[model samples]
Target: AQSVTQLDSHVSVSEGTPVLLRCNYSSSYSPSLFWYVQHPNKGLQLLLKYTSAATLVKGINGFEAEFKKSETSFHLTKPSAHMSDAAEYFCVVSLGSNDYKLSFGAGTTVTVRA
Candidate 1:
């Protein structure tokens, strides 16, 4: 079994600044983690993912995350924020037992201010 918890419901940042979103997860076996972003009335897009192959993962739109086994955390970060980055983000954990079984976090809404 694998599960993910998003630590924040909302995150606000200024345009052209930095961004951070927190997440925690648990799994019975080694887990695969993912970050997804969704804009209003838009489909979810894969932001990044962490597999056994890499501890650090980078994704499109200057987003990245680091897998920390010691803390059971996979936090998303961006060196600079853009207004277009305003969206809802989800933390996902893959249940290795089942290919279709995936747990999703509630979601964190990111607001970019001018």
Candidate 2:
């Protein structure tokens, strides 16, 4: 069985500061890694994804993450934070290209202070 673990359950950042969210995962086979953001009272939006080609991936809103095989990690980061960026983030792992068998992390809540 595969699993995804988010190291931190919450992260707080002041507006205009940098942001970081950590994640780790284990899988029997090579897996697809993804980061998604859920705004308050809204649906989940795909942030970035790692599908084996490139280790570094860039997502919308100046978000980016690196897929590290040695550490089995995929950490998301942003150069600057905005108030709107305050949301819950999730790390996901999917095996063999099927969405149904995906495993989601507990979630990291980001709070941006003015």
Candidate 3:
């Protein structure tokens, strides 16, 4: 089984500044990692995923994450922050090929300052 832990419960970023959401994971075997963002009253949206293909994975809205096996971290980052980026982000992990069975982190709330 795999588990995820979001290092920070909340993160505040000024508009146009860099945004970083820290996350760490532990898995018995090679695991698949993902980052999902959910806005207020909206469904969860896929940000990026790493499945042993590439160390650095890029996603929508200029968001990206790097899978570090030695560090056991999959941190999400964006070059610049936007007001629309304010939301809750979750770190997800799956052990096998079945994506349905996933383990999600508590989540990190992002607040964008104007």
- Could you say which candidate leads in lDDT? 3
Identify the runs in model 3 with alpha carbons over 4 angstroms from their true place: 97-99
Compared with the true structure, what per-residue lDDT tens digits does model 2 show for residues 20-100?
999999988778999999999999999999989899999999999999989999999999999999999999998565555
Per-prediction count of colliding residue pairs?
0, 0, 0
- lDDT tens string, model 3, 1-114? 689999999999999999999999999987999999999999999999998999999999999999999999999999999999999999999867555688999999999999
Give per-residue lDDT, candidate 1, residue 41: 96
* Rank list by lDDT: 3, 2, 1
TM-score of 3: 0.96
For model 1 the TM-score comes to 0.96
Once fitted onto the true fold, the runs of candidate 2 whose alpha carbons sit more than 4 angstroms away are 97-100
lDDT value for model 2: 0.94
TM, every model: 0.96, 0.94, 0.96
